[model samples]
Target: MKFALQAKDILRNYANILYLLIGITTGCVIGFLFGNQVESIKFIGDIFLNLLFTAIIPLVFFTIASSIANLQSSERLGKLFAIVAAVFLTTVIISAAVMMLVMLAFPIAQDDTLRNMAAQAALDNPVSSNSNTSATGLAQVLTVNDFSELMARKNMLALILFSLLVGFATLRAGEKGKAFATFLNSANEVMKQLLAIIMKIAPLGLGAYFAYQVGVFGPQLIGVYAHPLALYYITCAAYFFIFFSLYAYFSAGKQGVTVFWKNNLTPSMTAIGTCSSIATIPANLLGAEKMMVPAYIRNIVIPLGAPIHKDGSSMSSIIKLAVLFAMFGKDFSAPEMLFAIFGITVLVSIVAGGIPNGGYIGEVFAITAFGFPMEQALPVAMVIGTLVDPIATLLNANGDLIASMMVTRIAEGKHWLNSRLPS
Candidate 1:
């Protein structure tokens, strides 16, 4: 019985890592061996991403509504929101600073050769050139002309606001509200279970997706754009370890840092492989549980943070901005440029949920916010977003758990980690 239990524990702990390794190995082998023929298996990746996308809307709506409804009092909800918001804002500011410094240290220079290659690539794969005409201003983002528009993935900010309204209304509706909240809670569980089932096949899905991407793009692109891509990967790793570790330590002390990294291993790997923070929420919640955070805190913070608190997106946006500025021969050190980068990245990060490949959507904001040439700048930004998205998602997904821990510590006012540790 003991050996069986130990074996089960090991498998459970290492499942995500095993899957990631298998997927990467399979992708490399298939991509190298079959070349463009690997595109035939692209459907496997599409199905996986589609499955993840299908769950994101309901998961966000139900989880947020249910979490707020369960708060049971306006005061508790207010306090939770305040703490979460403060932590999120602080992290965003830190991420922005880190990104700025990294960009300054390793500036991407424009190369005509690379630009020509990118142009060729864009020509080979003709993407829709339609611009996002939706309201990106603060007022428009917060306002909905039609409530139905909130259902669209692109209107994530409006969707979250609508969910909050529904949650609050459910709280005020007496017994009817209670029943509805209960339904939402049940629905949230169902969505989670659905995610768990989808994750079981992640190896096959991620493998096919990566194989297709590599086969289509080939190693030539990586070689052409190695500097910025490598720099982005290295910077994200530093932020994950240095900034995140320090945040955890301050929140819950040495033991807090220990528990956080120990429990986050699988979730971090899962994020890298799947490249979707929404898909990794379940694993993050499990990590929070392992760190001894209360269920209420995990339920509230993880879901809400997944969409709103995007440290990774902020970092990636900075990278995109840096790349675009260099490619267009604009000075990134200008005060206005710095302010615009900070403001737009923070705003866009909040609404990054709902849209498929939403990371690329930031390019639209860059057009309006910084007046970059849409024709030249947008394509380069899109390519950069695609290449660095997996790492960005990994950062976003891991930061969600870390931020949850910080919020838990603040809300509970007691060291949640202390009691769980050995003497």
Candidate 2:
């Protein structure tokens, strides 16, 4: 009976991953067979994307506000924040280091053919034609204006700030604060339920989206830009499996690694299928529960990390920077440029979260950091982002779960996998 139960549990854990794989495979096969005709199915993908976007603002606001309001004490909140921030920063530093070493080992040469094609494509594409618009400075990116703007999807940083303030205020409002916190918590629960319902159609939604993507981009573009895309995917996979697994082992021993992979498999698959970390939050929280992370820690870290801790974006940004540098015949090895890339990539990753098709933000930063002609660079960057977004999303979503484990380990002085240890 115990063995049968164990097998059932394993199937439950891995079922989503299996479904996603089947959906992706089916989508690709249909896409190749039908080509651009699959464009008709894009509305199905749009519905899924819209469903995710609809849930994001409320989910983020309530989840963050309630988590902060429910913290045991101000001291505990501060400690949790510090631990999560440290882990995120450390990961970004490691990512930057890995990127530098990888680029050095396999330098990409200038491809004038591809460059010209990109330029021509940019000329023909209206969106790319205006890519030379004024650069968005870091100051502008950080600044928040009115409440309306703050609530907008483009201003996730501002929304997070607002949520934190409200949460803190609720914590101090005596009984009234408690009441408000309860409301937020209830609201967050509702959003999670809505997400679960929406996800029932995930295979269909994701399959249609993937089919449309393949049909539109086709195999030709994949062949044309295969090298950098392959490298980016491999690097992300390495980080997700190798570095993350090692980190888990060290943090929680063998049991930690086992729980980490088992719990995270579905979330990682959701990330790839949806190509949005925000959309994967519900699954990530479920994974956190499965891994035995405390509810308070999981609630706070996953929501915050979804937007703030973006290891996947950092790595992809580095890849884009390196490939663009090579294409432009610029030396990326210069000390000043390398430092600038590292700093900017880290900053951009934070702001880039919660925005759909946000990989282009890296290109904007690249334009500012490298003094590159935007018109010449934006097209190639867009192309790179399109191909690498799914893998990058996988990393971003997986990192959130990993951060939850690390935070639990640090704050509770106990490994999440070790139920014998008190949390």
Best by lDDT: 1
Residue 166 in model 1: lDDT: 85
Q: After superposition, how far is residue 248 of candidate 2 from its true place, in Å?
A: 1.0
Tens digits of per-residue lDDT for model 1, 1-423: 997976676566446656655775588578867889997897886577567546656766775677667775635577788888999888987997898898887777666644554454345334311223455687776657886765554455566667788888888886867778889889978876776776666678767765765676565534545787788899888998899999989879887888888898889877875677888899998888888888888898889888778898888788888776765457877776777688888976775653344443345555445644344454456556766777788888888899888998888765667766667
Number of backbone collisions per candidate, in order? 0, 0
Q: Give all candidate RMSDs, comma-separated.
A: 8.0, 8.7
lDDT of 2 by residue, 153-197 (tens): 455545666888888898888676787888998997887677667
The top-ranked prediction according to TM-score is: 1
Model 1 regions more than 4 Å off: 1-76, 111-224, 420-423
TM-scores for all candidates? 0.60, 0.60
> What C-alpha root-mean-square deviation, in Å, does candidate 2 show against the real structure?
8.7
